[model samples]
Target chain A: MALTSEKLAEPVAAPALAEDTPSVAIRNLDLAFGSVKVLQNLNLDIRQGEFLVLLGSSGCGKSTLLNCIAGLLDVTGGQIFINERNVTWAEPSERGIGMVFQSYALYPQMSVRGNLSFGLKNQRLPKAEIEERVNRAAGILQIENLLDRKPAALSGGQRQRVAIGRALVRDVDVFLFDEPLSNLDAKLRSELRVEIKRLHQKLSNTMVYVTHDQIEALTLADRIAIMRGGVIQQLDAPQTIYNKPANLYVAGFIGSPSMSFLDAETVESGGTTALQVGARTVPLDGYEGEGPLAPGRKVVFGVRPEHIVVTDAADPAAHVTATVDLDEPMGSDSLLWLDMDGHKLSVRIASDANYAPGSTVGLSFDLSKSSIFDTQSELRL
Target chain B: MTDATATYTGPHGPKPKRRLSPTNIMLYGTLFVVAVYYLLPLYVMIVTSLKGMPEIRLGNVFAPPVEVTFEPWVKAWAEACTGINCDGLSRGFWNSVQILVPSVILSIAVASVNGYALANWKFKGSEVFFTILIFGAFIPYQVMIYPIVILLREAGEGISAVTGTNFRLMGSIWGLVIVHTIFGMPILTLLFRNYFTSVPEELFKAARVDGAGFWGIYFRIMLPMSLPIFVVAIILQVTGIWNDFLFGVIYTKPDTYPMTVQLNNIVNSVQGVKEYNVNMAATLLTGLVPLVIYFVSGKLFVRGIAAGAVKG
Candidate 1:
């Protein structure tokens, strides 16, 4: 509850758009290696100055899709438009995009200043202009003091800063980041995550980031595209993806300690719809979904740990009676594992509250926040 | 508890090693024998080379010279004869320089480009080309000697017909240079290819995204980062071409013979008072170039080889 309040404290203002043209667009993008399809029929439109994140577990084609957008990988069939220009067949440099890699691929032999200026020099930019751009980038990255040092002479975070400075000096319209902070330790990862979020706010360039960490996707992305098996499972704003997951996978993936599922059958009596769980019937009032709940239909009731309340006394009108199986006390809160009939459920409570094993407790469910899905299709209904 | 604490005196740490334990004896004994086995011949050579002919004829090859003289080294440098040229290895030394310089430069330059292309900018059929090139490394050099001679002769004749001049590669120093360059290519290319392949792919991709073309990446990124490997290639080619005797004797005439071939001539000539000191001095002189190169860049050679070994 404290974490939710802290998250709600900060307002995420949507960037206002002056024009309708998307900065980068991909249509029917298809990529494969020999015969193994990595990404199939993928489509995306990144609005100007938008922060879009491609999120998934490993080998889910998120990085592959970022490479495709950067023109690093040759697509099997598709067209990519950058700022209204067809760049599917173009070189990565010609796509007017700057990219940062996870390995901090700054030139090892070159000084940080040389790394920033090498690209400009290759483009035949004037020496003064190159110097100016390199200095400006170094200043913005706060790496001006480390300019003369080689990459090996710097720490991991400093080297990553130089890598970002290398991209920042290009002044491209779009920025592509391929898990740029995945190499850092946890503390540095969180620090750099905030730095990257602040960077996006300052630059406001159309940025596409790739990461497998759900916390990163939730914190840094304006809109997150969750991918699985080379397909986009759902694409929406972070809060919407959290509160209103489109499918079972999205609901399970975006939460920590994950949402628990309970098998139930829909029942109707006297024009009142309810769910029968084991031997107890819970009212299905205020439930939001696509269609009406019919009697005798098999469905799954998914609920998050934070949405359930445990009462000391077993009220007859309570949702279900559960026995306290185990109690785990985390620093800020405690998680109670309870057994209802033959099913297991986890509920979050304040850390100070402790329950002994074998104690009977009544649980109340928040009907408005819970989800009901078709048992066979696993889709929200 | 006080009695227990007072009596407690267990061993605190690891047992100290003796200076001459059985394992140490066996290890150092084997090492000493190997060192003597390799170094004894060089020691004998050095002692014999510094002694006079009279001292050498006394039959004690290991004895230090009563009176040391630089005469043998001087004679080997300026007076010893190879065929009709009495100029000794001096002439052949210059000839070897011509062949060695161009051969080392050309072979390393071309092989490094071949490696960079194969490792990074892979074209269609590059693996097949690499396979064939590496395949050349396994073939015996003696088997290719005759065919290479024929190829050189035909190339010379074709050039003579076109240029309207007496142009021949059959018995010239340039002919030997080309042979050494071609022979050095396969192994040197493999060394460079493996080294370049071990460089992270992300750096190459980063260079490409930075607008670096093929040659730009080669000169700015690949070339600078690969200095250790280049030192490795240079050392391999220099020593291989400089100490070559078979190619020198077969490809070039006596006037253009390399130092090794001329040293052979001076030592194995049919009619001459055998000069043991001169021969030893000349043999040492022939090996000096590669010895100096190995000592100067030995550390980088190990690092380069280790780098190549990692990914392959």
Candidate 2:
């Protein structure tokens, strides 16, 4: 149970000690079933000890990619490297990765201890060593009391913990999780999510997690790989992916109460760049990008609901007036769906902030925090 | 009791009657009729088997024996003649045991492995063979009996050709076992296949990820979880092979005749005066194995059959 840093580092071979050698490197991966192409030339490099989450909705190849990395799936045309060793044709167990499934696939007929020790027994490990590993895993997961119980007798949370313990006892270099918390209730899911994050912190082992829940992706991933249509849209830190999405799809897909988009035209007035929406022109200040904003370029402007602000005594040059069409009073904040010159936009405010339907309010779009994409390409500009 | 106003009934209230309701009467009445209908034959068999030969001829079958005896049972088991074998059903019973034990084990072993392969490790043309086999089950044995006899004869001739001596299959209990196994294949395979298919795919995948191969997963996970269906298959095969008269008569020599055929020959032989008491005892004895199995496996038989029929 006392898994010190040195003990956890016992499995690393000396040849893999080179700095900058990625823990898992996937190159030009292609997968297909019959005629349907699921993944196409996908490439990724997972750093050592990094928690990388492959995040997307269903049918996006996130789980498929994780399975390929774990050697559970055969890639049609590609090479996979783990710790600088080519393992594209290796067996799943030989790949040195342990997986946790959404169903918590524990052996139903075995006690929790038996389930944890089954693979070790299959490999014919020494009895005392297997016992020590199992006890340590049970202690780490705090499932010592549940060790004697069958899977059917445990609660959902306890079963999932045992499933994690099964992987932990394997003493693998990487852990693959395929929506492990999806089957739990909301309360258990959040609690287990925190525990998983803590586990990652304590072990500092590389983890490749697959999830459709954006909260899990954002909170747990050191780098979140936002995928769409079998391609990695953006791979960056959580805040970077959130604030500066690579494309329109990533921007639209990441947030709850999704970012509102408005049709606009990029125009240059004097020497400053500004976007004109309907009759109002908002200055684009501190818009960090590569090139100058050309005049007369059609674009779509995006803003999160919480970033739009309403103020009566506003800077006349910055504030744009709109009418509140609907007000939704959430417990801590109110979402005001406003009519900005016939374009619908939503603004988030404190729950106690007074605002009524049909009331005229002065709304300001913070251009510094907003995103703009070219209309035709749908790429962030 | 009088202290509680809620429990006290007014004097003017209608008197409560304790007569059975019409629904209860109808339910119990139908159940009693069904029970009598089912038990009537067994009742007659036991009573008739206990009576003296003269007494059975004089009284109705529903009447109990005036002079009770177990002589008919003893004669039926050890002394009754079946085509000059006065050793009675004992030889046939042991022959059936020889056929039943091996047939049940071999049939189930082959069928379960076939089912697991069909359900999990699917190869090209496996399904075609399975489809043909299932359709083969619907064809009556009478249509294929002659071909099977010829096949066995040719197989024996092939061995004779190689070994330079007569190697007979037509007069052996092994031939009858092979027949029962072939006939019992379709339904048993279908039972095991559907049951294994209903197991969660994720569990199988997880086992594979845990370094389990085909036999490993089957022995460690699938086999343990499928005990009920195996019991169901055992029950089906045991009863089917034990009571099989057609295959027993067709495949084996008279020396290796199973209990059902021997019982038929002993009771229905036209040469002697009819002994109703002895006939009833032999019939009961022949039916005893399946009866004991059905009684002991009562609830599990029902559950297993239902489980095999449906998928989750």
Candidate 3:
């Protein structure tokens, strides 16, 4: 990774970006609270200088997993490795990992100067060295002028910066953020997200972040780990998770307006593979969805909301008839709700889509981009 | 003045509405009457104090005096009678200060330590300890006094042996101070516990992640955050101990009696001249510490109690 101040953050496609070495690796991790199991046999690998996002809903054990790695929580089973050294039983400070809590957790009584310098002071560093580190962190977070202000006097974004600066001053090997941007307003979240990315690039620190918003996971994660029910659904580059999702869960979870699903049995109508939805068999051309599928056994067909297109000039064999239930115009794209085979589905159409409530419309799926899933396991077919 | 006054600031450039009608006038007037009723004792005290022995003999208890003098304030300070002693309330005042100062200071500091630990440090049996300690507060002092006396007697003799003299805490100023502190601990600790609990857990977590250990969190974060509550605790503890009669009576030697005990002896002496002026003056003087506290902290009472109860 090269640093160029002239073109600081262009979000360039990384062709030469190495598969960086694992800075953190958790093996066969199990976390439990009394009789309830939260994380069961979880394995994770975070590479050096890589921004890894743990994407999940609340109580899905994303924050718990990060806490285990941060040494703020204990692992009941697995071993945690930071830079190839086992840190399963190590104290938090000894692990050299910095965590930004969801609340920002800035000390209210302490000035920004005091908050950032607290760690160094606790570590019993020399006064001059502490001052130097504080100054450097302040510069990095661009909070030099606000250093004298109390946390109450600072805005959410400024307080968040001070929190980041507190971590930066420690110069830790890994930085863990547990929903850092969740507290900020929409505008501030985006601004701080960019700042965090720049910070990571400049420091080249391996960072593992947790957030519920899929957009955040997509934008900031070099590699996103989509999780469900305390299990990692997929771990891949953002586009890979978007395009070639490993399972039905990942496919549905990654995209906004979500991917739609229908259980249908595979049949051959003419030379093309067709799905028998109730009594009508819909055509699926170039359907090479490769997973276990017994002919006549129910399997699922999936199409993203954006993939469903409505057209006036329709081919009867190629498209299905849909009655629009509701429509939402979202700037460039409009979402249309329609009923098909007793299931209500949403279609993301162009904002100029000449459709209205209760209107009969013809819908087509780009079957080449469609995915099939085994109904029982919900895995990609 | 009360009705027109408003704390609201708005776009109307402060044209505070005058909503005080006849009903409001009657309400305010009745409140003024009630306030004077509470002040009646103080007014009688001042009137009686200004009267001489001759006027007092008339026994017109509510009558204003023809002549006024500052003799009682002077006499109470340096010449009022104690049993077999008319040396005045002046002599016992220093003893009161000595007993009161250390008792208040020591109790407050100890209470803070207990409060911080009970509130923040969640360990095994910590809740049980807190529950039992709070339950201890509900126990009648009279029920526990006998056992406490026995413990003090045994402990005092043991100390006297070690010091090579007939020494004991049974009737010492130190004993009284310790007793006040232990009794005061439950309430003070309760105040501080509630106070510390309301402080955002975020502050504590931030300190810990920044390499703060237990002592670090307490001193650097919890202590600084608990200052307002600490002030209130000190005020409450001071007033409670200063006004304490039974504890001071039972625990202290005659030479070490606090203001309350001395005032009691001078006012309630058997066959003693009922010098209403001196009694009232002494009590008013004795009530002065809490009165001053109430005045100083009156406005901030709500804030001082509920300062950090909610997140900002």
Candidate 4:
């Protein structure tokens, strides 16, 4: 083994809270439906002007958490504070927040202008003031030409824009969005994703977005709260969450095609630490320290498909050989299904590097950014 | 580009003239037969009502009258007799109006609110009560009439005992209105409940977040959006209350009889020669209200009742 003197960096914990007052503060909140607890002891603090995303699969309490913050669902226990006021028992409207729904929820009978102005008119605001706010919102959302058209006349993208405009006209400090782009097609979802990012940049209002789409969560969120079974598995910045996940679940869920896990044992030889898989030993020089590494410790080593480099046969670090079983050409990158030591592994490499099937290739593992989970505890170590 | 070449192409490949397919012919033939079957009674009624009494007796029911006259319609509307009163169904017609306008309005108002509550503000035991109410719709009105009558009589008696005024609801239009409202509640509430339930729950949530209260949401959102269902409910109740003979007979005195009861009495009276033309005219007149309502609300009635068949 060639020893490289690389100091293992410490994995960063949760980022420090910003100095500004929190825009929305959720205390030890709990929500239960009869015998089923949907969320338990959940605490989240959203900073002013920050884009926070709550992400999970369906029935994972992400949308339920958004509803609780919006005051659409009554919390069974604990308090919700928006703008430093306890709004736990307040009505959804009085909570000083606006919301956009996945279904758009535009009144079918009303025109786009009517939909945007209905709430303001209900507050008995003056006609000119309502017009001014509505016009500004329509201009901001680029829906001025659609003012007179009913919801049925507009397409899905236009309807969502109107929904966003409805929230915009309210001129509130915080906005809650519940899977607003899930109804759109893939092209429209990406288009609206950018518009929403632009909206956050322009308006600079604190937003709480809920979605199950990991791409949207990664692209749009300043911090992502990955939830599972009503419990938040990890909460951190996108880069940190992507680079150093808190547990095996986060690691598996965050990547497309999922990360590959290999049963390995930590081995130490000549003051060098490494992981042994079958007959090959890979260096652990770049792994960030979670706890003390010891010899003969069992672990499940994980590596993302993109991080497994197909190395030249003559490279000194190339210790493993795999046969390419199949190739999925995805335009810019190709995913190769390989068999290494009787384990199927996916390797995403540049599409131009055409590795034909049935060909043998040498592989080098990038251990610096890999994950190692304790076998017993299933947590990052 | 030459005219002769264009003409040659057009003559060589002329478009085929449109023709109806066998499927279209079969479908239209079935529809025509069904239409005639439904219109037969209406044709007989209209033809019979236009004839003199002698002509109706002389000819078969299907034959159009050789000599038509307006005398039956005039007598039916103004002078036909029910018991000692010769003032005709005009009295009962006006009585129907009095009972109808109030009954329709009151029943729809109460049932809609009840449905709204059952749909959105579901409290404890609400579903139990709504289920019982909907099941009550299947029970025949006759089975429960006696109990309802006794209940109303006792209620009136209780009021009179306290107020010293004999509040007699047994023979009043107000009594008929109350009875109609009670009977109409089950079906109307079901119709409105299903319709309100079909409304996207998100809209209700959006309205709540828009600062709308209970009545505000109802008037501004639910009521406006549910106009079709309301039209359906109105069409239902108007025909039901207008054509009711049994309830009118049991609940009202002879003087306050509705058009249906009065029409029945005038036709079936034992003392006079059977004026078949006059009976047909009176029947046609009594049936006019609902026919008008159905005709006016033609497409909406079809659309409204099918409201919750597909989720929006």
TM-score of 2: 0.92
Which stretches of model 3 miss by more than 4 angstroms? A1-21, A74-77, A246-251, A268-274, A278-292, A316-319, B1-22, B63-65, B84-86, B162-167, B308-312
Give the range of the ten consecutive residues with the poorest summed lDDT in model 2 chain B.
B1-10
Per-residue lDDT tens digits for candidate 2, residues A247-345, read 788899998878888899988876987888877788888776546878899999999998788877355754578888988888888888988767888
Q: Relative to the unseen true structure, what is the C-alpha lDDT of residue B92 in candidate 3, on a scale of 0 to 100?
A: 70
TM-scores, each model vs. reference:
0.94, 0.92, 0.89, 0.92
The global Cα lDDT (0 to 1) of model 1 is: 0.88
TM-score of candidate 3 on Cα atoms, chains taken together: 0.89
Which pairs of residues clash in candidate 1, taking residues 3 or more apart in a chain or in different chains?
none
Each model's DockQ score: 0.73, 0.59, 0.50, 0.68
Residue A269, model 4: lDDT of 65
lDDT of 4 by residue, B221-269 (tens): 8998998899998999999999888889998998899888999999899
Candidate 1 per-residue C-alpha lDDT over A1-381 given as tens digits, one digit per residue, 9 for 90 to 100: 423432332222122233689899887788998789998777777899989999999999999999999888899987899999999999998999999999999899999999998889888999999999999998888999999999999999999999998899999999999999999999999999999999999999999999999899999998998888887777789988887777788888988888878999999966988998878888998888777888898988888899899885557657888899999999899999999877889999999998999999999888888988888877777
lDDT of each: 0.88, 0.86, 0.80, 0.88
RMSD of each: 5.7, 6.6, 7.4, 5.7
Top of the candidates by TM-score: 1
Docking tier of model 3: it is medium
